[model samples]
Structures are given as C-alpha cells and as structure tokens.
Target: MTIPEQIEAYLTSQPQAKRTDLRALHALMLQAIPGGKLWFEDGKNSEGKVVSNPSIGYGTRTTTYADGKTKEYYQAGLSANTSGISVYILGIADKAYLAETYGKTLGKATVTGYCIKFKKLADIDVEVLEAAVKDGVGMTGEN
Candidate 1:
C-alpha cells in the first residue's frame, strides 16, 4: 500500500485516536522547521513505499540544512491507541554529536543515525528540537 493508504489502514485499526490533535501536532512540527518542500505525502526507500502499521498515519517531508545536507522528515501512523504520535527526523547518522547533545533534552527519545522517534509531541523540546534539526541536516533557522 501507499504511505497514505498505510496511514489510513493503521488509523482505522486503532481502538482509539485523537485524529485532530495528532494531525495538528504533525503540522506544527513541519512548520517549526526551516527550508524545504514540506509535504504531506508518501516516502520511498530502497525497500519500497514506507508503511505505517495499523494506520497510525505516515508522511514524509524534505528539508535542507545549513551545511547543505538535505534531510527527510518521516512520521509513522497515528498510534494514539498504542504509542501516541511518532515523529521522525532523518540524517541522525550524520548528526550523532547533535543527537548526543540534544538527545537529553527530550529525556526519552529513540535515536538512530538518521532518525529520532518521539512517542509524543509534547515530549520534544521545541528549541532543542529545532537546533538538532538544523544541526543534523544543516538547516539554518531564523535570526
């Protein structure tokens, strides 16, 4: 299935959800970041189209960093019924130092070379989160 489809399926299978809240939160994350073609669309990896189990809501957006590295923001389906909302930042592998430093800001964050997954939007520190995004993918923020 496509990313949108995957999101739909996942959300539908959920026993409970806060759809508006989750979507708004996701949109806020995209808006808070800097330059790129922000989009609410599917993502393709070498493996094929990304999928969100049980329709949790999957999406991908692209952004450019200050150092000239481009980054992708990917979200898994809406999982308010199970794990809440998950937001992912790409290029973690290239931003290990940033992750190491800002990783503590969230208190509980899942780290990978190219991804940081947070169980809830509130768990993220907006300032630190922006800095990490800028540092990780090289996106410069407002003055």
Candidate 2:
C-alpha cells in the first residue's frame, strides 16, 4: 500500500477523526522532511497480519554537517492512535546541544542519544529538525 493509503487506513480506524484531520497530519509529516525516501515494513506476526499493529515506515534524508561530515536520519510515520511521531538521528553524537537549542520549539518533546519524540507534527520546528538531520548525518561517519 502507498504511504497515504497506509496513513488513511490508520486514521479511519481512529475513533471519530475527520478525513481533514488525516489529510492535515499527512501533509505535516511530509512537510517536516525534505528530499527524503519513504519506506514501509509490514507489522505482521508469523501467522497473519496484526490488526492493531499495521506497519512501520518513515522518510529518510542525508546531508552534510557543519563539520564537513555526512550522515543520514529517518523520520517515521505515526500510528493513528499514537500520541506523536518520532524523529531518529540514529548516530547523533551531540544530542544534548541539539536538544537544548531546539527544545524551545519542540515543546514537551523528549530527546535522547539519537531519538526525538514529538506528540504532534506541529510541535516540531522544521528548520531545527533539518539542522538536526544534517548534524546526525555528519556525526554518523557513514558513507
């Protein structure tokens, strides 16, 4: 299934959510990252697909960092019932600086070594996120 379809299926299963809400959520997720690839993984048990856990997928981007380093980071789509979506800078070496600088706009978000979780797309600051992505890519030391 396509990303939008996956997102729609997730939204439809939610209680009393309007179509517009789902559209808005999808748009925000797309707008949060630029020039990224979308990925999907089936969330199924050995026997059959799990009704509640549909799939896991997200977008990924790569860029150069301030220190002339390159890296890649991924942002995942949310389950309809999820309180928020997660932003992962998997090889981030400087989480503290990024968190402190970007936390003001994140509002109630949490940050760890290489993960940032925000409940709503709106809570994230796109520019800061982009910067974080670049930083992560650079620190990763991966080509």
Candidate 3:
C-alpha cells in the first residue's frame, strides 16, 4: 500500500482514543510542514521481524553511518505506543535540545533526545508541541 494508506491502516488499528489523538497529531504534523514528503515504516527489519511500533513519518534527510553507508529517512515521525503516542524529531545535532527547551513546558509529556511522548493530546500543550516540531523541522533543514 501507499504511505497514506499504510498510515491510515496503522491509525485505524489503534484503540479509539489513541486513534483520535494520532489522527489529530497527523494533521498537526502536516500543518507544521506543508508539502513535506510522507512516509510509513511498518516497524520491520530487513528480515521482516517487527522491531517497533508502526510509524507515520514526514519530511526527509540523508543519514550517513559510521560504516560509510548512507540512507534517506524521515525528519519527523509519529507513532502510537503501548501507552500513548510518540513523535520523533530527527537530525538534531544537540541531543539535549528537546528536553532542555520543551520538556517542562510540554505538560505531561516526556521530552527525550529526539522524541516527545504523551498519553494523549489533552495531556500536553498542543502549541508547545507545534513549536517543538517546527524547531525540529528547522534543525533538519526540511522546511
């Protein structure tokens, strides 16, 4: 299936409340990065083993590994976790940016090196989240 279709299927498979939150977040991500490329990762490794939750991604970046191989991936990602949701902001040079800048202000969310996680949209400040996402996208030079 296409990325949008895969994302829809992933969201549809979520519990009702989580699905609602994910849908809202999906819209918010699009608004933050209009015309950004869309992506869907089925959380499978090359062997097709499930490695993580399915994720809906946005934007693009080229990443080079220590082994000298390079690959392109999303600049931001959204996924439903066992407890709630996670938004991954990639390409930040400073690992502390998210936590230092938005951790306390984001309400009941956990701000990690590249991820903002919360149980629901109502648990956090959407505006703060948006700002963080914007900053993240800027860090990747994706906007």
Instruction: State which candidate has the highest TM-score.
Output: 3
TM of each candidate vs. truth: 0.48, 0.51, 0.96
For model 2, how big is the CA root-mean-square deviation?
A: 6.9
Error of 1 at 46 (Å): 11
Query: What order do you get sorting by lDDT, best first?
Result: 3, 2, 1
Assess the local accuracy of residue 74 in candidate 1 as a C-alpha lDDT between 0 and 100.
41
Q: Model 2 residue 44 lDDT?
A: 63
Off by over 4 Å in 2: 16-25, 45-58, 61-85, 119-143
Residues 76-121, candidate 2, lDDT per residue (tens digit)?
4434336555555554546576577666765666776666676665
Winner on lDDT between 1 and 2 is 2
TM-score of 1: 0.48
Pairs that collide in candidate 3 are none
The TM-score between candidate 2 and the true structure equals: 0.51
Better-scoring candidate (TM-score), 1 or 2 = 2
Model 3 clash count equals 0
